[model samples]
Target chain A: MAAPVRNHVWVGTETGILKGINLVKKQAANYTDVSSVTRDQEVNAMCWGDPQESEILMGCKDGTVKVYSAEKSKFTEFHDCRGGEGVFRGLGVVDNAIITCVESGLLKVWQEGASDSLELQVGAGVQKMRHCDAHRQKVGTGGKENDLKIWDLQKPEEPIFRAKNLRNDWLDLRVPVWIRDLDFIPDSDKIVTCTSYHQIRVYDPSSPQRRPVLEAMYGEDPLTALSITPDGRSVVVGNSHGNIAVIDLRKGSVLCTLKGCAGSPRSIQCHKSMPLVASCGLDRFLRVHHLNDKELLHKVYLKSRLNSLLLTSRDKWEEEERVAPVDQDVKDEEDEVWDGMETVEEKTATKRQAVTREPDADGVVKVPSSKKQKKKKKVA
Target chain B: MPHIIYSAWGSTCPAARPPGSVNNSCKYSDAPAEGHGAPGPSLEQDVLLPPTFSVSEIKNKQRHHYMFLKLKQDRRREKLALKKKRKKERVALGDKAPPKPVPKTIENQREHDETTETDEFAPYFNKQTTPKILITTSDRPRGRTVKFTEQLSSIIPNSQVYYRRGLALKKIIPQCIARDFTDLIVLNEDRKVPNGLILSHLPDGPTAHFKMSNVRLRKEMKRKGKDPTEHQPEVILNNFTTRLGHSIGRMFASLVPHEPQFTGRQVATFHNQWDYIFFRFHRYLFKSEKRVGIQELGPRFTLKLRSLQKGTFDSKYGEYEWVHKRHEMDTSRRKFHL
Candidate 1:
């Protein structure tokens, strides 16, 4: 049960099972009871409940948002939100309230213990909705034929920034609008989106122009998921054909393509600080790639098709290894006792040797003995 | 002259030469060359000859062929003598002889895949629903493709064969679901030969697209049995052990009826070897308790999986569970996915 604290990634599978993967230990454990869950409860979207990331809000296909507390290693609560016709496209938490958006374009904010919740229709065919981490009241929604729109939760009457469709092509035919995934660029009002038409667009809400300021195309297949890098200089986007590439925001050129993805990637998320990105998809494997070296650091097969994944925001992974040994000490008292006895035996042996040689060389023995004591204290 | 003859004889019969003696001969040969007094003529001739000698180095065509034949015969004789000695030793030991070593194969040395759990085929094995398959060919399928599809429909019980007529698969899927079709099989033809097959399970799906080749219809197969009867044929799936393999095996299993009529004595086998699936139809007759005679029924072909999608046939939008990337997945000959 203590292993959940060290899990670096949480994956939601099509089989309705949530798995916590510990890359350091090379182990993955199912957090949900496999026997009790059905396919209808398949996890569609997942998000952190708070800035601390101690709780995970998982939106299931059956129109229920289940809150899982990482500290408790179990589900803390379940909220029913069944007004939409399709599965949830996004989930977010702001000020203890849960924000959920379904594919049918029904976006709702359920306040804590409230019977009547705030509901709004952003548009039909909502493919993705993302809540801005910097601005708690701001959320972005986009979908098939639905342009990118950022709405302020406080005033749900109208959208704050609505993206305009691109101009007609060379033949004067209208370009289709299908935004598969979007993310708000941290430290700014710019929203980066990847479309099913294999286009990546960056929208600036502060500017007067409603059209995207920058547009880039990666591959022939439709882009399914994208996550902005922590530095906000590049965005990692994966298409429906198992190809993942990092696109530079400034120049709109591909930086590098991450290899070893055999199926379409369903979800991709970059670490908050470290140059690491974790992605999982229909390939049934969660792969963590280093953003700089483009090296595959870890790959774990979760046995089922993964729908979404959430990577922990906690940095300093080496610090966790030091803390893990202390947790093990509480479980194995006999091993701790043996370790303590061995250290005491070594100390007494050194003291006896110093005493035996003290008479022959008093000043020299004292110098080495004092140094040994300091070294022993540091070891303890 | 004697040293030159000895070195040449040593090169001809490698087994006669003692270990580490090639260096010794080279050392001995170098001493005479440095001295250059008694055997000057022989030394000059030896220098012209190669240090290492083989039959292929012979200059005359007739002599080269004769020497090569003799060398091969010597090697074969030595191998046979060694085998005979081992057989004699084994016979002397009798019951105490060690067990024979198992031969290594690519399949035996294959890398173990982690995801080998097999619970996805529960519905098919449990016999919850009977198979109702709809078989169709590509638009304006040629004579050979039409014949292959017709034979495929006859092998599976309760299946209907329909003309494609340029109808879109996306549109036909919903109509098939409404009519309670459990599975849909589409044969794609190029140049009048069936080259592709798409098998999509109805309602909710796990569609599999395969590259099909080597089609042999009933008329083409020699000594073929009569056309397959309407009785349900038993399905036999071989070597489908991995997780992805199990899913494919289940897809094939769900295409036929649950129970087989023993009276028909027919069998449809999907045999997998090196990731290539060979489909065969056969009719058997039990002559006695010890003997059974089998006859081949028509329309045999091979299939190699291209991709397995999670949902129905939406190539542009569907998520693929496993896709065969030639450069990535096919790195090792010993590693197999199915």
Candidate 2:
């Protein structure tokens, strides 16, 4: 029986191209646009519509949301998000609604009919919006001059948590506010945000202070994207200089850096069960690395700069292991002594040539010794 | 009168009776003047007269409200009289012209369907001459602009260069049009750096404007030794700022022939043209770090379509013609002001 195929890592490119890589086979498939018009070709954001990740929700620069189904290998539906300004900065799926956010901080939750039932203004110039399935109803938003805000879509009249700006420095100067990417700590009220100032801050809503409880600085370059590891104790972050590293959540220390990336990373995602991390960026390469020792597992050159990616839950290595066939007609003959083979014609012919290594000085028929063979070769 | 005055002062005022009334004795105990060390020797029978201003006439002091009301009523009456006079005049004049009864249609009278209207310069299409482009920049062109124009002329076959110093666009455009120039490419400067570009086709036009940023030259490119002019360089237009911009950029890039060929003894090589056409097309997240870094979407190649036009673009021209075809493909022509 053939091995069951695992999940495919999907990447959305700036050219509105969708590329899927099957890690087991190390194969890539490209999906082109159905129309010749290039307006809707720049894919700005992407999200999985279903829990099993069979449906992909792609947001284009033209404010159109395209639903592509992996099962059918074609786009299932296209819905225009009318009045949505600027490129889509975030795309998410919550229950029966398709949630989208633009750079102008217009967040809309669309039902099946594409009518926005719940809409919100997260303030203008929003850079990133993050929604975790674990906390299905809540989302986090932040950007320039816009502090981190956590809102419950079900009750969005007021944010559930609003972060305050950190206190002025010792010299009494205002601190800059630019939150690039954020993630909700699984099963907890804690949130981690990586900023353009190269700072990773952890905010606990349950705490007394409204500011981040733990603050630590990473590299000098601004961080662009981050994803929480499976265990939820560490976060893997990627910066504008194509530097990706893991940080310990408890101590906020740099754990290890993953190498071989050159341009700014656009997205970083870690699988829920596997020790694999998938990242893609302006370098136009999709890279998967093992979290254990940071060994680069697979690298695929996508034709365009990638904006976002989705790592499905299925493990290809496990399926490959299970389907690896076994050979049975083998014999262990390396150390076998064949005494009956000496009388065989073919065996004696080969043995006589091998045994006639050097003629002795006395012309006596004796087995060739190491010293005598060396001495005979020297004399010749 | 004094008793009436005391009663009118109300019970809350201990001074209502001038400290002579026994009924107010308890309220006067806290008075510091008569208590402790101060001596109060003089006691005179003082008579309080009526106040100079009448207390019951505050309502009479508010005269401005009624005056304003009267003024408003007078203005309304005057306006009504003027309107009646105007109406009478209009009725008398109605028989003469009737004001070209407003052209009733779906569109406003001022806005002709500009995209669908046929341009006046269609006769130039039959000439079959290669496009002659005039490349120039704003007054006092920067060093970068001059260098870019030199590089640009070498890419596009018969393009010429000029500086708009001490000359207006109105003067230059007409002169170029009269001189048989097919198109004009203008680089606008901000702080002595080229930041915006305008490409207008000759005579009549569907001009395109683009925001140019992150200008990198061949010397700035990472890979060296490969002459930028050697190969027919592939153009990459990365991350256009708008959807319409993306569509227009793609339309422009598609004009270049896929394979270069020599029609006679001449072969035109498009070299550093891609660099000028492919400006950094990205939205900066923070204004402070503007143009420092980019979230490059992907490589996108763009060309100035107007600068390549042989004849004026008419939306009502041939169906297969790019002018009308692109106008149809891009539904948001209103945004790009096409």
- Give the Å shift of residue A111 in candidate 1: 1.1
DockQ category of candidate 2:
incorrect
- The top-ranked prediction according to DockQ is 1
**Model 2 bad stretches (over 4 Å):** A1-7, A34-39, A113-116, A316-380, B1-338
Question: Could you give candidate 2's per-residue lDDT for residues A185-243 as a string of tens digits?
Answer: 88789999998888999999988889999998888768889999988999999876567
lDDT of 1 by residue, B231-289 (tens): 88999999998878988998998888888998999999999999999999999999999
Reference-based lDDT, residue A278, model 1: 97
Give residue B227's error in model 1 in angstroms. Answer: 2.5
lDDT of 2 by residue, B1-338 (tens): 43343333323233322334544433333343243344643333111212222223325444435434544665587678778987787888888734645667764545533223123223333234346788888888877767766665655556788877778776787788899886777877788666767666666653555566665544454422223232332344444544234434433443232333322112222212422344432212343744443333221223343322223332111011122223332456343312
The top-ranked prediction according to TM-score is 1
- Tell me each candidate's TM-score: 0.75, 0.49
For model 1, the superposed segments whose C-alpha errors exceed 4 Å read A2-4, A323-380, B1-126
**Which structure among the candidates has the greatest lDDT?**
1
